[model samples]
Structure formats: C-alpha cells, structure tokens
Target: MLARTLGALLCAGLLVGAAQARDYRYSDAHLHYVDFFQETEGMPALLEAMDKAGIEQSMISGIPVAKKWHEDEPKRPRYYAGDDADAYWYSATDSYVAAAVEKLPPEQRKRFHPFLSGINPVDKNAVAHIERMLELHPGLWQGIGEVFTRHDDLTALTSGDTPRANNEAMTRIYHLAAERDLPVLLHSNITSKRERNPLYLAEIEEPLRNHPHTRFIWAHAGSSMEIHRHQEKMDFLLPTLTRLLEDYPNLYVDLSWSVLQPYLLDDKGTPRKAWLALVERFPERFMLGSDVVGRFSSLGEQFQGFAPFLDALPEDIAHKVARDNFLAVLPKPR
Candidate 1:
C-alpha cells in the first residue's frame, strides 16, 4: 500500500512538469557575445546570468565582417621569384593569407584555441571559422547568428543594388545554417535599399520565398532602430509587425528591448492598443533578451534588463513567450 501511494504521487509530479515545460520555459532566444578584445571578456560567466533571470539559454552570434579585420578584400601583392622562402609566407601579405602565414603581424582575431584572422581569408576560410568553433569546444555553441549584412559593403561586393549582395550573403549564410541544421538569428533591418527600404516588406517577404526551411528569426519584430534611440519608430512598425505573424511561420520576435515599446507609447501620450495587439496577435513569436555584452553591474543580469518586459507580459502568455516558445526553434542541445 505504501509503494502504491508513492508511485501515484510521482506520476502526478511528472504530469505537472510537462505542463511547466510546455507553458513556462522562459528562454531568451536572442543575445550578443563579446570576446576579450570586445567591450569585455569572460564567456562562461553568462551561465549564471541565465540561471538567475529564469532564462535557460540564448542564441549566441558573432560578427561575420569585423572592424578589427579588413572590411574590404585584400589585393594580392606581386611576389618576386627570387624572394626568400620565409618572406613569401608573410601573414601580412593580405587579409586572405591571414594568421596562417608564418612571418606577419597578428590582427584583432581572438586566439580562442588560437584563432588568428588577419591571415585567414574570410571567403576561403568561411567554413573554417565554423569548423574551428565546433572543434575548439565541440558542443559549446548553441546557435549560429548575429551575422549582419551591410548595404554599403555588400553593394560594393556585388556591383548591383541591395538584392544582389544581400541575397548572395543571405544565401551563403542560409545554405551554411541549413548544412549544419541550425536555426539562424538575423538582425533584419529596414535600411537595405537606397531610396525606399520598405524596411519590412521587401526584406522579410522576399527571402522566405527562396529558402523555405532556413529557420531565420527577425530580432526586434519589425523594429528598425535601437530601443533607447528609436523610441519613435515602434509606432511605425505596428502594421508590418502584424503582417509578420500572419505570413512568416518560421519568423520570431524578441521582447528584449520592447519594454521600451510600451514606454514609447506612454511617452507619446498614445493609447496602449498596440501593446495589447502585440501580446494577443503573436504570443508564441516573442522571447526575452537582455542584450548585455560585457561585465555588467549585477550578477544574472538577464533579470535586470529583462524584468520590465517580463512583468508587462500577461501571466499565462508571459510563460509561453518567456520560455516554452523559444525551445521550439532553438538548436537541439548536444
């Protein structure tokens, strides 16, 4: 009789657990990471921050084109036939030869397991970066993203307007993500085109047509600028934000900076209708993000920046937005 009673209680507990995972995971699907040379260091410290904020894991992303490295491709230096064998391998020869070339100045590349980039030609060694990260700490990375597309640089690369370069880079990253079977997080902006960016319409709708299963997420919903600065544009993004939920099944939005979305309304002395619309229209598409990069003031800092947004969320809907929904898109844990 005692054994039967304990077994019954255990079953009850398991049922409730499933309910929690389904309804209240509270995962932050978007985040940025900075290495030693960036604003700050200490990569492993994020584990504690996530634990305290009730955030489970975040999608970590790096810069594809970095300021530390050359934004433009390097011109190959003419080599003389009689030059010494050692000078022939100078890593400084160009951005393509990168750190691998023996005798050359080291660039801003972080030596994570000794990753040096000045000699690593991004185009040729694009696959190598992914390989290095995987090999260095086999399963440490959760997702691949925060990769950005610059309109100016890409236009110069492609020769045509926005579509040419942006599409090519998007296709490149999309193919790589699909090859590795990881969902990508894009810093989708409305400023791609020269005259009329159409901020949301052209960028989001067009890309999905080519790569159907690419698992591309749009950070900030349809937000164009940063929360602190673009306090005005939240109202502008409303119509497009609504359209995203209806059209893009794979697309998701984060509420990381969106507490400011409501605050924006209050500042303008406008009705709170748009805020309610966001909560009601796409509860599943939202997730929390702190957007902290370096050694922030508080420990488990997700709670610090994320508290306002989380508090504004409806209780049951908050549970889904904060956690359970993101697990649907996150890369499977190794």
Candidate 2:
C-alpha cells in the first residue's frame, strides 16, 4: 500500500512538471544574429537555444554598426555603451548573417528569415549596398532592417550623420523595399528622453504615408529601452499607436522587450486593459520579438514574460501575435 501511494505521487509530480513546461510556440520577429561588437555565439549554439526555447521560426539580422574598441581603453567593453567609444556602420555584418544561414542544413535554413541591416541609413549611397546584397544573396534575404534611425544614446554614440526615417536616403530605401515586396523593420524611436510628447512623429509618419505599398514593422512601436528607462512611461504612446494603426494599413508593431514593461504588463506583471483593447481592436497588426542580440539563452524568458498579456488576449490573436503575425509580414517567397 505504501509503495503504491509513493508511485502515484511520483507520477503526479511528473505530470505537473510537464504541464508547467513552456509549450506556447513562438516566431521571434526581432533578433540580432550579432552583437554590437559584430560577434555571435555561432549557429549551433543559436539553434540549440531556439530548440530549447520552442522558437520554431525567427527573423535574424546583424547589427548595423560595430562598436569601436578604443585604443585608450584598458579592457574590452561588453556592450556598445560600455564606454565613450564610438560605433560605425559595418556593411560586412550582413555578410556574416548571410554566411551563417547559408551553411545551415536545408531544414535548419528554412527556419530563419534573414534581413539586411548593415548599411548606414544616413548615406544616400546606402541603397547601392542594399542592391549589391540582394544581387549577391539572391533569395536568401527575406526582409530589410532593424534600421537604426533616431535611436537614443546609440545615435549619439554612432559616428555618422543622424538617420531620420523620412530622410532622402530612407525614402529611396522605402521605394526599393516596395519594389522587392520586402517588409522593413524600422527602429525609429517615437521620442527621446527629457521630452514628454511624441516629438519625432513626423519622421516615421511621412514614410508611412509615402510608402503605403511597403510593410513597415515599427520596432517596439517606436519605444526603446533608453526611452523607457528615462521616462518610465509614455502616456501618449497607446493613443498614438491606435491612431497610426487606424490610419496606416501598411504599418505593424514589434512588441519586443522595450514595450513589455509598463505598457503591455504593468509593474505587477498584469496585462493592461487599455493595451489589451488596442491589440484586440487590431489583432493582425501586432507581433512578438525577443530582440536578443547574439545570445539566445534568455529567449524563453524574454518571450514567456508576455504570458500574462498573451493569456488575456483572445486565443486566436495570441497565436497570431506569438507566431503568425510575423510570418504574415514577410515578403512572399520567389
């Protein structure tokens, strides 16, 4: 009798453990294959991480700029903002992404959607780089960007003319994206620190108006970690996004780490009703992303953190945001 009871308890524990495991599927809409230093943990490690995290598909790209290791510094910096060292546009980063994906087995290759992101957006000649990459890679690249425009301190730290979403260079890029039927992931922050309003609204709005044919995944829905760290919350963000989604059919939002705190989930990690309503109103327009750079260990946690928000959403919408929405935005394969 004692042995039978112990066996039953052991089986119950196993059942509970299996039930608690992460079974929710995910398609990571925003992941960097390399860090700011232009380094990666290799493809094998990445694949392992993805398998562990239950990421069936991922949108992978390289960081547009490489942080410079200043000669004066005694030790190497772990991140871009580690010291006063400047970062510069490194087009070769794209090649790294291309090479990494190409070497994978056919089954593994299909799981990754590569995006071109190493060109400096401020340069008018940037489009040439895009053209060259497309020609070189053929159908390997499915999208463009995580394009750095008006990023907070990174803009100040990068060495180049500040990129604007509506700038002439980006205008040309937008036209090309439309021609290629490629969706563009744009990281044009809605506001900088110290300003309370959506100060840079026109920058992104102009392109959305002009390039209706091209799909634009607005990274973080125009928020960033820096902006959140400083401002805590943007009171205007939810309403602004609502208006934009209502206005622009081509626009989509990447709900990565930046928007998770204070917006989607409150301080207590509960889903906000206002955000839930906004997502329910435009269920097709929002997607999930890990936004993990070069490392994938935290992929599960980054995505699972949204469980509360996803649970609050309708089951169909939750699945869409977690996986299908991102796949919908990618250009149809040739």
Candidate 3:
C-alpha cells in the first residue's frame, strides 16, 4: 500500500514538472518592428505583448524595402503582394526601428536586439551603405537582415533588379558579416507555393557553401506566409531541410508559424515523427520565431503553438528550441 502511494506521488510530481517546463520563455528568432505599409503598433505596445507572451528577448528588424502601390489597384496591399507594385529600397524604415529601440530605457533596451535591414541587397553600393550604417550606429546594431531574396509574390513585385542570395553584392555583405561576427537572417523562399518544388534551392545553397563562416538563419526554413495561405500542404520541406542541416553547419532554420502547419504537425495536429527525428538529430540547428510583423497580439499564440512539438521533445532540447538556441546564435556583445 505504501509503495503504491509513493509511486502515485512521484507520477504526480513528474507531471507537474513537465507542465512547468512547457511554459518556457522564448528568444524570438524572427520578428519585424516595422512594415512596408506603415502598420506598426509602436514600441510600448510591442513590449507589453512580449511581456504577456513571456518573450525575454527578440531579434527585430525593419522591412528593407517598401512595397509600392500597383497603379491598377492603387490601394495599399491588404497582405504582402496583394496588389503588387514594385518594391524599392527604403532606408528610413531601418531608422524607424532604430528610433523605436532608442526610446526604451537602457534596461528595457537590452531585451531588444536590432538588425540592419534597409540596404538594397542587389546594388554593388550596398556594401558601402551597410558599412556606413554600422559606423553610424556604432555598437547599436547586433546583426543584419531578414533580407528578402526569393520571396513568393514580393520577389515578382521587386522593381529594377531582383536580389539573389549568391549575388556579388550579397557576397561582399557576407564577408563583412563574417568580419563583424554578425549573423544574417535571410528570407529566401525555397520554392513557389503553387509548384511546391525546390526551384530556387541554389540561391541560398551557394551562400551556405561559400560563406561557411557567416551564421545564416534561413527564415521559415525558406517557407513563407504567402505559401501557407495558398497551399495547405508542404511535401518537400522536411527532406530539403534535413539535407541542408546535414550539409551546412552554419545553417540554422527559423521554424516560424508558416512551418508549424504540415511540416511540424500533421492534419490532425499531432507532431510528425520524421520532423521530431530531425530535430532530435540536429537539436541545435532549429529555432522558433513568431514572424510577427507590425503587430504584437498574436505573439503569445505563436509561441504557444509550438507546445505540442516541444512537449514531444526531450526537456533540454525543448528548452533549447524555445529559447536558448536563438541566444546561442546572437553576436556576442562587444
């Protein structure tokens, strides 16, 4: 009778422990402080949402370029590339992010890490522009990008020259990133949503192969919100990510909201075994992101959505994906 009672108590204690662990605080690996359409809720609102969501820190950047209003529609896009005007480099967007960060008290400011995102990645002058921003900001910026290279509709909308990950301009930026020990958060879509083929694989692959020293966080593991909206399933995502993780030590995937569907969880909302195995095999290579743009209310739901997957993981690995892994990749404070 005593043995039975003791066993019951131990089981109860273990369950409680697991429940507590599920509420892990996060260091959001991907987020945007401003949007192309000027739709941000501003800093105080963002901080409140973060506090509610238990996000201890976040990687924040401005949209590097602004989406123009397509003349046929001549209205602001309800979503990314909704009407599809050309995208052009807008440096002031980065300044908005910088000024927002500057407003916080030093103690509060430490919780936010800002990245430079305003440079036109295709322009040869981009290298000089980035260098100028770095010199202007001193130690204020922590990393570079959320750089959009192969976005679904947005890539089609970009005017003049489209940016490619392996372009000579990006090559120079990669060299600078290596020199400064800054990680680059690149958003190059792996494939188009309709085709679901790894069509632009080489764009990101070349940079990974060439710039092995520069830490590259592949946003959404190369998936996008636009893709998620159009396609209910992502068939090729797992194998492609597995190959990349195997091939490149410098590559880390941003498993944000778009990846949660079909990749992380199945139709019934159960964690997929293959993905679990991949996370287990390369536990340090994956990180979580809310991918929230210009707003903050959904932040809690975004982090909470990963609970099922995290619960399936070993406690340590769950904690790492939830928070620690992101902190690990951050540029060490100078």
What TM-score, computed on C-alpha atoms, does each candidate reach?
Answer: 0.60, 0.93, 0.91
For candidate 1, the 10 contiguous residues with the lowest summed lDDT are: 108-117
- lDDT per residue (tens digit) for residues 272-308 in model 2: 9999999999999999999999987899889889989
| lDDT of candidate 3 over 1-334, digit per residue (tens) | 9999999999999999877765688999999997777569999899999999999999999888787777687566866566646777887777888888988899999998899888888887887878888888788888899888888777777776777898999999999999999999999988787876888899999999999999999998988777877776668878888898899999998999988987898888899999999999999989999888898899999999999999999989999999999889988866
Pick the winner on lDDT between candidates 1 and 3.
Answer: 3
lDDT of each: 0.48, 0.93, 0.87
Question: Which candidate has the highest TM-score of all?
Answer: 2
Q: Kindly list the per-residue Cα lDDT of model 1 for residues 230-323, writing each as its tens digit.
A: 3444444666666756777766766556444453246554535566567667777766655554453343554444444444557777677666
TM-score of candidate 3 to 2 decimals? 0.91
RMSD, every candidate, angstroms: 13.3, 3.6, 3.0
